[model samples]
Target: MTITPAQVRSALLARREIAIIDVRDEAPFAAAHPLFAAQIPLARIAVEAPWRLPRKDVTIAVYDDGEGLAGQAVAQLRELGFTRVEELEGGLGGWRAAGYELFEDVNSYSKAFGELVEHRRGTPSLPAGDVQALIDEKADIAILDARRFEEYATMSIPTGRSVPGAELVLRAPVAAPDPDTTIIVNCAGRTRSIIGAQSLINAGLPNRVFALRNGTIGWTLAGQHLEHGRQESIEVGDGVDEARARAREVAYRAGVRRIDAGQLADLEAESHRTLYRFDVRQPDVYAAGHLSGFRNAPGGQLVQETDHFAPVRGARIVLADDLGPRADMTASWLAQLGWDVLVLEGGFDGDLATGSDGAPPPRGPEGRYKRPYEGTDNPAAAMQAYLDWEYGLVAQLERDGTHGFFVI
Candidate 1:
């Protein structure tokens, strides 16, 4: 069986449960792939397929760029008991030949959505040089690093604290109590920074908020020094109540729906609709105790890498967090990004499951893609190319015309 690009596009528009998978390695897949295509690399099919496409009969379409991997992938999937696997009619070349668009880089659609958000909202930002000047002058600005703690520890702006994206709305009050203090958000590159800064702004924080334009990349390009091994992090203390109220309000304004335990069960009962249940709390908290059948996907990273977590574009997502603020805030962004997202309401005390938090096992280094936005040594040309691609995303999305993303 072979599926055409037009059929795949129709499936996406209809919000059907179809997985258009690229069976090539990371590099080439990153170079170009359909907007909704997920990279499952043929080498890691056995490890990723079973969990990624959990339903045995879910529609699965595999494609490659004339590398002849799709046939093998379809055969392997069938052997693994997948009942609805097929090859892409034209492969990668075929999709291009059929006049379909191909997106670049990992998490392409999510990054493109971020670009759309910025374009639509005109999110405020400060260039790296201006931010550095404020730091030198000891200005009353709180620089929040929106990347993971590990990434922040590797290298961060001189005095930036590790607040990671989803935690921004919940911790911003605690980090910068003064309404007059300017808050600057930075990530390794653009998406998280744009989302984080916009998150605080959307939550209606009293402080002036701005994305550190181009994030750490811009800082590096500006020849500013970065701190290594920094341990600064936000502590949720006296402001928890306020944070919860603010976060819930933000979520409400973004059109997110709240579902109790019974409703969630009902959603689960709908076997025909693909549902992703995620505990959007920190890893340590999730590892300590999480709801049964829920996987640990920290909210910030979930928003940053939606394509990896929920490749089924139109699937329903339920976010769980013991503290309501995180889930509510995370769900707000997801809703704006066009996900059918719901926040699970109530205490976290049903059949609590604890341990590794249900994350899929990691693939070996051989299957991993070296991201151009990571590390300090990425070539200047590569970094510039990345920014160029991001700058063009809003236009690309306009041309694609299939993304249902809306800014609130």
Candidate 2:
């Protein structure tokens, strides 16, 4: 079968669960690609297909950089057991010809959505230049890399410390003591930065918080350097612990529900439709400890970009947050947006094991499907306009009249 770029665009807009594979070499693929396309070079197709795409029935669309690689790769994928493989008509060239914006770098959509969130919600951010000055002087600025620990280990800002996305709520206080040190949160790209920074601001922390503008993207573009060695383990204090407890209470106040392991199993078994469970914690934390049958989706982005993560729109979403604030906040938004969202309680204390079978199931491969807005520079006008809308969301939430959400 052959699918046109228009058809692909429409399918994505409609939230169809199709795997978009860009069958081009790394260099060409890196030059430019769609916001949501995952780059798996045609050479690696056979080896990576069964793993990156475990589901044989998922509709797969393969595209090349104007070359005829797509058609050949599609055939190979079908031959190798992908039941519904098809070539994108006109290839990646066709997609660009259709006038859809091509996004570069990684996690573009999440990054773009981060920019959009800041634009729409007036989410505050700190300039990278100013942040660098603080670091240069060895000032009291705390640069928190809010990505997974593995990502931080791979690459990070020189003065930054690794604080996985999920730990932001509980660890933010410990990271900044006087409430006077500037706390800037960043991810490899944008969504986590916005979500992480906004998380602290939303939770009513005493410290002044801001997202690193454009995250590491801006950092790189500005000709800045990064640190590659192991990050020192941060010590948490009783104050931070108290703050976490209070944050959990706030989450409860915001209408989050908690279900035990048995109840979770009941929910899974009772539902006739397929349900997607998520551990709304950092990927590293998830790798270390998580409930069986749960996928990792850090909290802020889950709420910010619900359609990508839970494309079904109507699927039951059960989130597990070791820190209740993140889970509660995420569920509250998902519920408002018409998803049947729930929070699984008491699942991740490191000491607690979830599955009734006693041994934990092997974890699934992490979702590597890239989002849209990763690398392109945004125009100032568009960004400011986006932030304006986001600024009033709280009041809009009040006016939205969809307060079926309970705090927990």
Candidate 3:
């Protein structure tokens, strides 16, 4: 069976649960493809197909640019028990012939959505030089690093503390108790910094907040020094009550819903719809104990890397957490990003399962694309090109016109 480009475009506009996969390695797939296409090479179809597309009946369309791999992919997927599989009509050339736009780079749609959020909300930010001057003057500021603790330990701003993105809304009040203290959020690059700073703003925090523009890249370009091996962490204390209340309010405002165990079972029973159950908490805590059948995806990393976690654009996501604040805060962002997300309530009493940290196995080096935004050795030209691409995403998204994202 074959599906045309026009039919696929209509499905996307209708928000149908369809997976348009590019049957090629990351490097070539990143060079050019549809805005929402997920990369799963032909060779790894047997390994990745079952997990990535859990629902066997999901509409799956595989394509390649004149390479004879899509046929093999369809055969492999059928052998794996997929019920509805088809090849994309005309492949990459057909998409072009149908006058559809092709996007470049990995995680293109997620990056584009981030740009749209910034465009719609006008997220505030501060330059590296100005932030440095403030730190030098010993201003009343709390710098919260939104990257993972391991990434923060690698290199970070001089006075910044490790508070991952999902932790900001829950821990910001405790970290900067004084309403007068300025709160600054930073990540390795732009997207998380913008999202983190905006999260606090949306939560209605009283303190003045800003993102470190361009993050560590900006600091390095400005010739500023970054500290290593910082052990600072956000402490949970008497502020837990207030944090939970605030996070619940935010989730409500963002249109996130709550589901009981019975509803989750009903959701699982719908064979046509794909359902993903994730436990958003710290790795150590997840390893200690967790609810049955839920995989561990730390809340912060899940928001930062939504494309990797839920590649199907319109799947249903249910987040689980023993504590109220973490899952609520994470669900709020996911809802605003156009996902059908729910927070599972009251399910920690049964015999807890130990180890299912939802991280995917590492890909072989041959299939990976060397990202230009990572590492210190990237050329000035390449870095500038990456920033330029990000800056223009809002406009590109407008041209593409299938994203149903909104900022709350």
lDDT for model 3, on a 0 to 1 scale?
0.86
TM-score of each: 0.97, 0.66, 0.95
Ranked by lDDT, the better of candidates 1 and 3 is 1
What are the per-residue Cα lDDT tens digits for candidate 1 across 1-408?
888888888988887778889999888888899898899888888888877776777788899999889999999999999888889997988889988788999999889988988998999999999999999999999999999999999999999999988888878888889999999999988999999998888888999999999988888888778888999999776777787898899899889999998999999888777888899888888888889888888999999888788776778999998878889888998998878999999758666888875445777778567876787788887887888989999999888877888888
Question: What number of clashing residue pairs does each candidate have, in the order they appear?
Answer: 0, 21, 0
Candidate 2 lDDT tens digits, 125-158: 8767878887889987888887766667767887
Better of 2 and 3 by lDDT: 3
Model 3 scores a TM of 0.95
lDDT (10s digit) by residue, model 3, range 1-408: 999999899998998988899989999998889988999989888877787788888999899999899999999999999989999999999998988888888878767876777788989889999999999999999999988899898889999998888888878888999999999999877888888898888878999999998888788777889888899988666777777888899899999999999999999899879998888888888889998878877888888777667777789999998877889988988898788999999889888988755555757988888776565667767666777888988888788788777878
Candidate 3: give its CA RMSD in angstroms: 1.7
* Alpha-carbon RMSD of each model: 1.3, 7.9, 1.7
TM-score ranking, high to low: 1, 3, 2
Give candidate 2 regions above 4 Å deviation.
132-140, 150-159, 187-192, 214-230, 235-289, 295-343, 346-408
